[model samples]
Target: MSAYLQAKVVRSRGLCVLSSIGKSVLNRDLWLVTVGDATVPYYPDPESPSTAYPKPKFAYIGGMHGDEIGNVQLLLQFLEEVCTAPREARLQALVDSTVLYIVPCMNPDGYVQLTRLNANYKDLNRNAYSSAFPYARPTTRDATIRNGYGTPLHPEAAWFLTAGGAAMEPETVAVTSWLAAVRPTVSADLHGGALVASYALDACDSKGSINDCPSVEAPLPNLLANAYSMNHKGMRVQLDDTYGDGDFVNGTTEGASWYTALGTLQDWAHHVQHLHMITLEVHSDKQPFGRQLAVLYSLNRDSLLRLAEMAHLGLKARVVDAVSRAPLLAHVELLEPKGMWPPEVEADGLIWKVAVPNMRYSGTLTPVDPGNPDARYPPISFNFTLAASWDEVVSGTGLQGLSAVYTMRARQARRK
Candidate 1:
């Protein structure tokens, strides 16, 4: 796989760049393949206009479960397509408009062993810290999960308060850290064992049976799920009428309604980072074999690309301190908690939110500085009317007419 990735770099003519997010439990390299123009800085300088290549970013992660081998292959093919596609193609526009981050193998140890858990025998999905569950963020980190089930005893906790939480695995740390750095506005976590796109707002019965929960944040998980399912001919239909959780509404299910999962990547990405991530169960009963790879690619190619484009369909804003003009990590939201999609500005001071087109949405941006309270900024409110089509306009910032990026200056002083 490493050689294939390197070959792509050579064949891509600077289109594909490879780097390591971190190591696996057994010290295997967690390879991160970035497919886009490498010359542009991820976050362009606000003061300098020419270098401001601000656009939405889309991320795809596969191979969370070791036995789900096809997940990794699917993303590999997607990367290859991106590298080989014509410069004038829609894929090129995706690359030009947004920075793409792909991590084909989030669990190399599991893939090598062909097991669902990592070398340490842990589910990487369950290893992440979730905002949905109110477990304390551990002060002193360790690799031991307090609850072997990877769930909370209380079952319903708000955000973590105390400095005591479960220990985490290395794979979880690596993926979470990488996700924080990338800060994808829209992403998809590929999986196997089923054939439907799953959104969030979850719950599992006592018998561990999954249900059909709807999104509190409507059109978020739903829109992306529909985007993927409607594009994939195979995803929208069910060969077996009675599947695990029965037929999803057009091949889409709410995360909670599917089952009660603890510390899920889907919940963590949305609740904590405001990233619109969906769990795509790519295959039917089990993982498909070599012969089915091409079919899987064919079914998912357009669906996945649609997700990349969806990243740019909503509001995009970059907020900074009004005084120093330096970037500030502020919390930006477009709706209430149910329809809510609030993304905190990355180090780049940018938030590209995914949303339904042609709607009027308003939200508030509150700057945070837990480390230094004096540096905190007041909340700033915004109102916007989205275009009927792919209307993501960048208002203000002396950059009207061009609806790609917006700069918001928060009136506050940086603590000396």
Candidate 2:
């Protein structure tokens, strides 16, 4: 890992470091490589004084399930490609506009032992706070012996469950801290066991029935999943009805509808962090080597690039006080296209609304008044119903890009 980082990442001007890992784990250094130019300033956040512009941030995580070696290798290869192939125009534009964080392996102990559990025998994927069945006291044999149970007793389990009062594992702590600090706009968690891209709502009711609950941030995930599957040679074409009568169309599933995966990383990222995240189950084989590696990379290279480019997709703008012109942490909501909701305003008073390409949306923004010491704005919220027709939002060029600074004004007082 160090050799690869020095040779490819460091030399290529990408930032690479051992973000965090377990002390007792064999390979304790979990590598975090970031590729992008922050100076470009794609979109600035007003609330965060540290950064002038909060560039669209995207995260690609792999090897959470340690035995899924292919997951890790794919990301490593992607990172190297991004670093070494700087001359690629499309890739360069993406790096300039967005910040990419790649975590090759999240569970080194599991990778070393070729097991799904970490050194503490905890399934890191099922240990997050968003997990429906978080690690508690043991009841079943799988929980106690195989470490399949969701119990916070394990140090590793505790770490990932930091949001839920679990002990912080060094590895989990590193990722949580980084995410909190960076606050990525989108993320993809890579895993294995199937060849499909799955989206959030991984867990269901207590009865364990599939949730099938649609996600508000569905457009971005659907766009990403389609990109990944369509780019792959055979992924889009379903060969067999393995997942109940052609369940996955175009290589994407709604997660819980396919299977109940409580406490998954993607769910935690979406619900808790309010980030558009998906789980990419890349290969049928957990470990692909030699020719298979090249073939896999070829299948998804363009798709990866396209996914990164999606950072600029949808609607983005800054919501500020109309009088003071100062950034305001506003509440932005989408009333139209019922299932999708807008992400909360960033520290810089910026809000991003992810929507389908051709669809119209009705959005509302309520900015907090700066002069008001109580932090309360007049009840006059700004409501905008844009794109009454597909042509309005999608021009001849397609998906008309919207980037502007919206100066919100408080309701004017009526004169007597």
Candidate 3:
């Protein structure tokens, strides 16, 4: 796998990057292939979410369930396709606007054993913890809010989240730690064993609705699920052979609504990382076979690209001190959210959240470090009209009449 990724780096003339995020349970390298820019790409370090990324960082991760090999194969194929695509191709444009981070397999131990659980018999999918369930205190994420997350909804939930939290597997630790550094704007956790796109990972709603989306930020997450389902050839039309995972409204379901998942990577990305994450179950069988695999790849081709495209459509801005002009860590939230805002994104003042295109979204920015200790600094409120395309952000085409001085570039207002 390392050889293939490294070879692609050479093939693409420095457009591709191959790096190991961390080691797996069996000490196998958890490799990540970054597809973008001819200039050697800058990898983000922890606590550095700066304008180093003028474009959105998007990731497609697969193989949480070692048995779900199709997801792994599909992502590998995607990397090949994009790397070989012509410089002027649509794939290049998509790459131009978004930094594509593709991790072909997250659980090599499970994959080698052809099992759902890792070598330790723990399900990697059930090993992620969300920091913002009962929600979190915006001022400091010194600790995860544990009000309602300590209990197990089912026996499977105990694999990770419970009264006695299990130790995180190496693969789980590798993923969580890597995410902190990359700080992707969007992510798709690809899976098999079913055929549908699911989002809003909370297992239940605030009003006790089972498997419903339980975030104040449901609209954008739902849009992510819809983008995959609507784009797939039969995700919305064909029902899965066994699990009945498909043929839903628009081929998308609220995750945990279709079925409950505890400590999944998607939920952690959404709640803890303040990212718009969705799970894509692209096949009916856990292990796909035969020529149908090619057909399946064809099914998700457009959705894969469109998902990255959506990242560019949302709220893209940066928060900085008016005096020192330094980036200020801030929590960006919708103005009239139905519930508490998702956890604060640890970025270098730059924030990009999925939003409805052509619609007006009122939002607020609460700085983590107010410049003046003597004076009171209240959350600054602002509004903007989202564009239908990513051109606004990619070209640094200037602002959308923003009230706050948020230049959507690495140096923020340098383009101004």
Top candidate, metric lDDT: 1
Q: Rank the candidates by TM-score, best first.
A: 2, 3, 1
Q: State the lDDT of candidate 3 residue by residue for 181-268, as single tens digits.
A: 8877778888887777888764552222245555567666777777677777788674433432423567777776666566677777
lDDT of 1 by residue, 1-416 (tens): 88998887788888788999989878988888887764465443345453343566778999998988888988998888887746546677668767788999999988987898878677776666554443333322222223677754333221121211255677778888788777777788889888888887443322223454455557657777877887788887743434345547778877665555556788777666666788898876446777798888988888887767776665667766666766666776656434465544555556655556555667787876534567768788876655544222211111122233467777764556
Q: State the C-alpha lDDT per candidate.
A: 0.68, 0.62, 0.66
Off by over 4 Å in 3: 37-53, 85-88, 130-132, 135-165, 205-209, 239-247, 318-334, 338-348, 364-381, 387-416
Cα distance off (Å), candidate 3, residue 142: 29
TM-score of each predicted structure versus truth: 0.74, 0.76, 0.75
Going through the candidates in the order shown, the clash numbers are 13, 12, 5
Scored against the true structure, residue 12 in model 1 reaches a CA lDDT of: 85
